[model samples]
Target: MERKQHGTGEVVFNAINYTVFILYTLICVFPFYYLFINTISSNELTGLGLITFYPKGIHLSNYIQVLKLKGLPRAALVSLARTVIGTAATVFASAFLGYLFTKKEMWGRKFWYRFVVITMYFNAGILPWFITMMNLGLTNNFLAYILPYIVQPFYIILIKTYVESIPQSLQESAQLDGAGYFTIFFRIVFPLITPILATVAVFSAVNQWNSFTDTLFLMTDSKYYTLQFVLYRYLNEATALASIIKSSQGPVNMNLQNMQTPTSVRMTVSMIVVTPILLVYPYFQRYFVKGIMIGAVKG
Candidate 1:
């Protein structure tokens, strides 16, 4: 009887846990779901605020319109290229620095570690950074987007923690076999910490992909604008129905002529920008989870 009672309690607890989990997940995902549904919904239905859980009418016209705008596609491509290259470079650099920091014998190790950590809290604010970029001639260039954030302190710390957790015995054994630091790091340490590397790569990629503020401040050329900046410009320039009707030559139903609602545009832009990340997220999610677990356990 006690065994059966315990089993029943376990089932009940699991049921409640799953219910809560599903509810929380839905809460988190509903905004994106709404954005997607509203983006593809017909402008007429969207103006009525009729789109909630599902789209009332389907139309790809908004996407077509947005794509037709100048500089958007180019900006997207630029952003994509920057994200791939920047993530790769940043990951490699972080891993190297992380490995170095894990070794106690490295010269000026304490100072270097402290300097890296200090950067996380103390940033040279935007104006100074902009001035520095100008002096360096990085303004209006692709490097403007990629150079400033190449080395992230938080990511380095995470990688260092994961690297330190790697059993010293493995490295010692490799050294006994006449292997150098480079060989051990590349062959043994890197492979063992693939999970953390993936996690950091995903994080860096996402940051670079969604980046806009730096581009806005640093990029003077239209060609260098990122997707987010282009989208922001579009949002700012989107015409209202009243403005359109005033410019029209013929009489129009001003009341019935709906405004170009920014809500749908915002949603569409968000969906477009976020689609790649969502697609790539699942592949690296396991790595992030595994990395976190390993770090937490061994840290």
Candidate 2:
């Protein structure tokens, strides 16, 4: 009787926990949901604050207008290329360094680890960074975005923690079979830590995808502008009178065309910029969650 009562209590507790979790999830997701609904709503309805829960009128013209603006597709492609290549390189380098740090016999390991840690809290400020990039002739180039932040210390630490949790006996056994460090790392270690690598890849990719400041500061060439940079320029131009009357000869009336309601356009731009990450996330979500749980606890 007591055991049955205990089981009932545990079930009730779990039910309450699940209810709270779902509520929190909804709270977190509501903003994005609202953004999507508002983007498709008519500007007049949105201006009157009528687009709270759902779109008032179904109009797809905002998306069309955003796309019709110059440089949107090319900027998206630039962002996509940067995210894919940068994330892959970051994962490989971080995993390799993580494996190296996991070894107990490596010389001056403490010193090297401390040096990496110091970088986490300190950085050469923006001016120096800009000067250094200029000196290296990286300005107005795609490599400027990719190479500057490829290896992040926090990612390295997470990977190292996951690597440490792998059984040391596996490495010893591989050595006994005449395997060197490269073989052990490539053939044995990497397979076991696939989950953690996937998690890191997701984070690195998201960071690179949403990045705006770096591209703005480093890339002056119109051809190399990332999606976020283009969106910012579009937003600024969309609200300016010059943009509306660029092809017109006479002074443009702001009240006549009603073009100031570019809030919907901004929302549409945001949706476009974020759509790829949202699509890719569900595929790796299981691995990402599992890796976080294991890596965090193991560390």
Q: Worst ten-residue run, lDDT, model 2?
A: 249-258
Candidate 2's C-alpha runs over 4 A off are 1-8, 241-260, 295-299
lDDT measured at residue 175 in model 2 versus the true structure, 0 to 100: 99
What tens-digit string does per-residue lDDT give for candidate 2 at 37-129?
887877667766788997777777567656766778899889989998999889998899888888878898888887987999999899998
Off by over 4 Å in 1: 1-6, 240-261
Each model's number of backbone clashes?
A: 0, 0
Error of 1 at 297 (Å): 3.2
Model 2's lDDT to the true fold?
A: 0.81
lDDT of 1 by residue, 1-299 (tens): 36544588898999999999999999989988988888888666776788889876676656755565568789899989899989998888889889989989899998999999999888778899889999999988888777777788888898998988888999999899999989988999889889999999999999988888988898888888888888777667655522432344234533222323566566666688888888998899988778866766742
- Span of ten consecutive residues with least summed lDDT in model 1: 249-258
For candidate 2, give the lDDT of residue 135: 97
lDDT of 2 at 164: 81
